[model samples]
Target: MKPLLATLFVVWLSACGAPEPATPMTQAEAVSIEEAWIRETPPGAKVSAGYMRLVNAADAPARLIGATLAEAARAEIHTMFMQDGMMRMRQLENGLEIPARGQAALKVGGDHLMLMGLNTALTSGAQLSLQLQFADGSSTNISVPVKPAMGAADSHAHH
Candidate 1:
C-alpha cells in the first residue's frame, strides 16, 4: 500500500499549500484617485487639460510637483481664475499642495493640468498614461481616459 500512502501524502501537501500573499502597496499608490480625465481636443487644438480629484489620506501633506506624458512636450500645473471680468490661466509655481486628510480638485474652471505641444489630437476614448510626480520623491502613473470636450457627447473608443 506504499503507492496509496504516497498519493495520500501528495493530496495532503496540495491541500495545505500556502496562500499567495498580496503585493505591498507604495505610498504614492495609496493616495486616492477619483474622476481622473483628460479633455478630447480637435485636430490642431495643440493643447488640452486634465482634471482629477486627489485625496491625501496620509498623516502628512502631499505636493504635486510636476507631470509627464509621451504625447505632450510638457505638462504644467495651472490655475484658472477670473481677472477683470476676463478668464485667465496662470502657471502654479512651486507646485500645488494637498493638505493631510484633505482633497485637491483639478477640474474645469479651476486648478488643472495643462498639456502643451500636443503631437496629435486627443480624441475621445483614447487611453493615455501620465506620471504625476510628488514632493515626497514618489510618483504614480495613471491611465487616463480621454473624454469629449465640455458640452459634447461623443463616445470615441480607445485605440
Candidate 2:
C-alpha cells in the first residue's frame, strides 16, 4: 500500500540520519531523593549537618555510600546515639540503605551527613551543592538549601 511504503521510507530516512544521543543509564536512578536540606552554621563553626528522605522504587535495596559538599573539606555519613546518658555521634562505616519499595530518612538526632572543616560559613537562605554516591556506582548531584534553625534543634553542636 502507498501508506505502508511511505512509513517504510520515513523509517529508512530516520535510520539514515544522525543517531539519537546515547546516554548511559545509571542504576541509582531507581532511587529518588526528597526534602534535602542542610542546617545553617553559626559563625566560626567548622562543621554542619544535612538531611534528606530517600525513596527506593527498585526491587532491590539502594545504598547511599558517600557524600561530598564543596563548602566542606570533607563529608561523612554519621549517626547519633545516646551513650552513658550523653549524646554521641559516629560515622556510619557502611553508609545507609533504602529498603526495596520503602524509604529512609537522614534526620536530626539520627542518621545524617556531617560536613566538616568548613572553608566558609553557611547562612540561612543559602544554596549548597551536594553529591551523593551509591553502592550501584552512580553519583548524583543534589542542590540543598540551608535552612534556619528550628526551635527544637537544641542538641550538641558539632566540633
Candidate 3:
C-alpha cells in the first residue's frame, strides 16, 4: 500500500508540473509588432515604404487603422495587386485586420505602408519613429530601422 501511495504521489507531482495559462494582456498590449523596417529612398525621392509583422494575441480581432510619422506628410495602408495583367496599388482606407491569435505582415509586392510626401529622403542606418493606431483607439509607437530592400534591386524611381 505504501508503494502504491508513492506512485500516486509521483503522478500528482507530474500533473502539477504543467505550466499555467498566460495572463491576457490589456487591449493596448494585445498587439505585438516585430521586424519593423523602412525602405531607403533614392536621392530626391518624396515617397517610400515601410514593412512589419503585426500579431494579435487578444481574444478579439484587431485592426491596424492608421499610422503617423513626422518624416512624411501622410501615411497610409496600401495593397498591391495584379489587375488586367498590370500591377496596381491602392489605399486600404478601411484598414487591415489580424484575427485573434493570428498575424499580418506588411511586405513588398503585397500589403504595405505608404509613406507619402516625405519631408526628406530616407537614408540607410537611420531610425524612423512611427505611431500605429488601432480601431480600438489604442496606439503603439515603434522605431523602424531604415535599410535597403532585402535581396531586391528595386528602385524608388516610380514612387
Candidate 4:
C-alpha cells in the first residue's frame, strides 16, 4: 500500500507539470569540421578551391547545403569526375551529404568547395573564414588557412 501510494504521488507530481522539454541538437552542433584548407590563388585569379573533412557525429545524416565567404561573391560545392576520358568538374546543385556516423572528404581532384568571383586575392600563409550552412538551417563558421598550391599531393597522405 505504501509503495502504491508513493508511485501515485510520483505520477501526480509528474502530471502536475510537463517534463522539461529536451533540448534539441542544432545542425552545427552535430557535425565537426576538420583539416580545412584553401589553396592559394595566383594574382588576378578569380577562383580557388577549399578542402575539409566533415565528420558527422549524430545518429542522423547531415548535409552541407551551402557556404559563404566574404572575400568571394559566392561559394559552392563541386565535384570532379571522369567524363569522356577527360576530367570534368560540376557544381553539386543539391549540395553534399555526410552519412550518419561517417565522414565526407572535400579533397582535391574530388568533391570540394569552390570559391568563385574572388574580389581579393588569396596568398599562401593567409587565413580566411567561411560559414558552412547545413540542411537543418544551422550554420558553423570555420577558419581556413591558405596553403601553397604546389607544395603537396593528397593531404591525407601525411596523416
Model 4 over residues 19-107: C-alpha lDDT tens digits?
79977677688889999999887788888889999999888889998999999898999888776786677889988999888999998
Cα error, residue 117 of model 2, in Å, equals: 0.5
Residue pairs in collision within model 4: none
Poorly placed runs, candidate 2 (over 4 Å): 1-27
Collision pairs in model 3 = none
Name the lDDT of candidate 2: 0.86
lDDT of 3 by residue, 1-159 (tens): 999999999999989887988875654589999899999888878899899999988888899999999999999999887778867788898999988889999987789899999989899999989999988888989889999888663433456
Worst window of 10 by summed lDDT in candidate 4:
150-159
Clashing pairs in 2: none
Worst 10 residues of 1 by lDDT: 150-159
lDDT of 2 by residue, 36-122 (tens): 999898888898889899998877888898988999999999888888897889989998988988999998878988889999999
Q: Whose lDDT is greatest here?
A: 3
Q: How good is model 2 by TM-score?
A: 0.81
Clashes of each: 0, 0, 0, 0
